[model samples]
Target: MKVLVVEDERDISDSICQYLANEEFLCEAAYDYHSAMEKIHLYEYVCIILDITLPNGSGLDILKQLKDMQKAEGVIIISARNSLDDKIAGLKSGADDYLVKPFHLPELSARVAAIIRRRLFEGKNYITLDKLVLDIFKKTLKLDDIDIPLTRKEYELLLYFISNKNKVVTKESIVEHLWGSEMDLADSYNFIYSHIKNLRKKLIQAGSPDYIKVVYGMGYKFSIH
Candidate 1:
C-alpha cells in the first residue's frame, strides 16, 4: 500500500516512513503544508498520515481539499493536540482515525492497515477472486489452495493488476505506482515487461488460467473472462 506522511517534524516523518516501509508499505513524506498539498494533488495513496499543525497551513485544510476533490484516500490525524474539539473536528472532517503524539509506531501501522483494509479492500484481510486468494496483510497469493511464491515486485505487480482487473492499465501508471517518482529517472520500461512476464509465467504454472492480457501498444489488462 502507498502512504503519504504529511508532517513538518523531520524526526516524526522519518520515523513514520521508516516504520511503515519496514511493514511493506510504500511511504512518501511531505514536511510542510505546501509539499503535502503538492503530493496530495499529484498522486494517489491508500492512506494519508496528516499532522494538523503544519508550517504554512493547517492539515485540516488539506483534509478539506481532499474532500473537495472527492479523493477516496483514507486520512489519519497524528498530532500533539489532545483536545476533544480537535479530535471531533478531525474525525468529522473525514479522517479515518486520529493518533496523539508520543504514540507507538506499531499502533499507527495497525491503524493504517485497518483503514486501508476498510477503504481499499472492503474491510477484508484478504481479497478473493475466483480461485485466487491474496492475503493483504501477509502479502501472499494462493491459487486453488496451493501457494504461489513470488518476489516482492512480482507480488506488488500482481496485486496492482488484480486490483484493476478488466481495466487497461498503462505501463507508465504501473511504473509510477511501483517505483513512484523515481521512475522518471528510468531509461526504459524493460523492467515492467520483465516483471509482468515472470508473474504471468508463475500464475500459469500454478494451475491458474491466463488473466493478464497485453493491450498491444497501450499496456495490459487483467481479466477472468
Candidate 2:
C-alpha cells in the first residue's frame, strides 16, 4: 500500500519511511506544507502520516482541505505535542489517529494498520470478490483454494482494481497509484499495460475468469460481470 509522510524534519520523516517500507508500504515524504499540499492534491494514498506543524501552514488545515474535497484517505497525525487539547483538536479535525513523537515505530506501524483496516478493509485482513481472496497482511492471493503467486506490482494492481471494482479506472490513475512520483521518469505507460497483461494471464492460468476488462479508449474495469 502507498502512504504519505508529511513532516518537515527530514530525519524523522526518513526514519518513518524506512520502518514502513519494511512493513510493505511504499512511503513518500513531503518536507514542508506546500509540498505536502501539492502531493495530497495530486495523488491518493492508503493513509497519510501528517505532522501537526509545517513550514508554511498547519497540517490541520491540510486535513480540513482533504475533508472538504471528500477524499476518503485515512489520516494519522504525528506531533511533538501530547496535550489533551492537541489530541482532541486533531481528532476533531478528521484525523483517524494521533501519535506523539519519540514513539516506537512498531506502535506507529500498528496504528497505521489499524486506520487502514478500519477505513479500507473494514477491520479485516482479507478482501473477497467471487473466486478471488486477497490477504492484506500476507500479501497473498488465492482463487478457489488455489494459491496464485503475484509480483508486488501485480498484487498492488489487483488490490487497486478490487478496491475500485466495477468502476472504470483510467490508465492515468493506475500509473499514478502504482508508480507515484516515479511516473515522471516514465516515457510511456507500457509498464502498466505489461503488468495488467501478466496479472490477467496468471488469473486465467489459475482457473479464474478474466475479471480485468479493457474499456477501449477509456481504461480497464474489474467486475464480476
Candidate 3:
C-alpha cells in the first residue's frame, strides 16, 4: 500500500516513513501544508497521516480539503492537540481515526490496516477474487493454494489493480498512486511497465488466470472476463 505522511516535525515524519517502509508500504512525506496540499491533490494514497500542527497551516485545513475533494483515502489524525474539541472536529470533518502524539508506531500501522480492510476488503483480512487469495497481514498471495512471491512494487501494483478491478485506470493515475508527489523524477513510464509485467508473470506462474489487461493507448484494467 501507499501512504502520505503530512507532518512538520522532521523526526516524526522520517520515523513514520521508515516504519511504514519496513512494513512493505511505500510512504511519501510532506513537511508543510502547501506540500501536503499538492500531494493530496496529485496522488491517490490508500491512507494519509495528517498532523494537526503544520509549519504553514493547520492539519484541519488539510482534512477539510480532503473532504471537499471527496477523496476516498483513509485518514488518521496524528496530532499533539489532543483536546476533545479537536478530536470531535476531526471526526466531524471526515477523519477515519485519530491518534494522539507519543503513540506507538505499530498501533498506528494497525489502525491504518484496519481502515483499509474495512474500506476496501469488506472488513476481511483475506481478499479473495476467484482463484486468487491474498492475506493482507501475512503478505501472502496464493492462487489455488499455491504461494506466489512478489516484490514490493509488484505486490502494491497487484493491490492497486485489484482495488480498481474492472475500471479503466489511466497511466497518470497509476504513476501518481505508485510514486506519490515525488514522481517528478520519474521521467519515463518504463518502470511502471516493468512492474506490471513482473506482477503478471508471478500471478501466471502461481497458476492464476491473468486478469490485468492493458488498454492500448489508454492504461490497464483488472477483470475476470
Candidate 4:
C-alpha cells in the first residue's frame, strides 16, 4: 500500500517511514502543510497519517478537505491532543481513526493495517483472485491451496497486479509504485523486466494463471488477457 506521512517532526517522520518500508509499503513524507498539500494533489495514497498540528495550517483542515472532496484514501489522525472533543472532531472531519502521540510503533502499524483492510479489502484479511490467494496478515501467497515461495519484491509485484486486476497498468506506474522517486535515477527499466519475468515464472510454476501483460513501448498491464 502507498502511505503519506504528514508530520513536522523529522525524527518521527523518518522513523515511521523506515518502519512502513520494512513492512513492504511505499511511504512518502511531507514535513509541512504545503508539502502535504502538494503531494495530495499529485498522487493518490492508500492512507495518510496526518498530524493535527502543523506549522502553517491545521491538520483538521486537511481532514476537512478530504471529507469535502470525498477522497477514497483512508486518514488516521495522530496528535498530542488527547480529548474526546478532538477525537470526535477528527472523526467528524472524516478521519478513520485517531492515534495519540508517543505511542508504540507496533500499534500504529497495526492501526494502519486495519484501516487499509477496511478501505481497500473490505476488511478481509485475505484476498483471493482466481486461483491465487493472498493471506495479508500472514504475508503468504497460496496457489490452489499450495504455498508459493516468493521474494519480497515478487510478492509486492503480485499484490500490485492483483490490486489493479484487469487494468492496463503502465510500466512507469509499476516502477514508481515499487521504487518511488528512485526510478528517475535508474539507467534502465531492465530491473522491472527482471522482476516481472521472475514473478511470472513463479506464478506459472505454481499453477496460477499468467495475468501480467506487456504493452510494448507504453508500459505493462495487469490483466487476465
Which number leads on lDDT?
2
**Mind giving the per-residue lDDT tens digits that candidate 4 earns over 1-225?**
789999999999999999988888889999999889888876778899999999889899988777777788899999999999999999988899999989888889899999988876889999988877899877899988999998887887777777787777777777776776545736547878899999999888888877788877776677763
User: Per-residue alpha-carbon lDDT of model 2 for 1-225, expressed as tens digits?
Assistant: 789999999999999999998887889999988999898888889899999999999999999999999988899999999999999999999999999988999999989988887887789998887888899878899999889999989998998898788999999888888877767635648888899999999999998899999999999999775
Best prediction by TM-score: 1
User: How should the candidates be ordered by lDDT, best one leading?
Assistant: 2, 1, 3, 4
lDDT of each: 0.90, 0.90, 0.87, 0.85
Kindly report the root-mean-square deviation of model 3 from the true structure over all alpha carbons: 1.6
lDDT of 4: 0.85
Off by over 4 Å in 4: 68-70, 185-188, 216-218
What TM-score does each of the candidates earn?
0.95, 0.94, 0.93, 0.90
lDDT of model 2 at residue 119? 84
What is the Cα-based TM-score of model 1?
0.95
- lDDT string for model 1 (47-133, tens) is 999999999999999999999999989999999999999999999998999999989999999999999888767899998888999
Q: Mind giving the per-residue lDDT tens digits that candidate 3 earns over 1-225?
A: 888999888999999999988988889999999999988876788899998888889888898888889999999999888899999999898899999999999999899889988898888999888888989898888888888888777787888888888999987878876776667635749988898988888788777888999899999999865
Better of 2 and 3 by TM-score: 2
> What lDDT does model 2 reach?
0.90
lDDT at 102, model 3: 97
Cα-based lDDT at residue 112, candidate 3: 87
Clashes of each: 0, 0, 0, 0
- What is the alpha-carbon RMSD of candidate 1 to the true structure? 1.3
lDDT, candidate 1, residue 173?
A: 81
Give the winner by TM-score: 2 or 4: 2
- In candidate 1, clashing pairs total 0
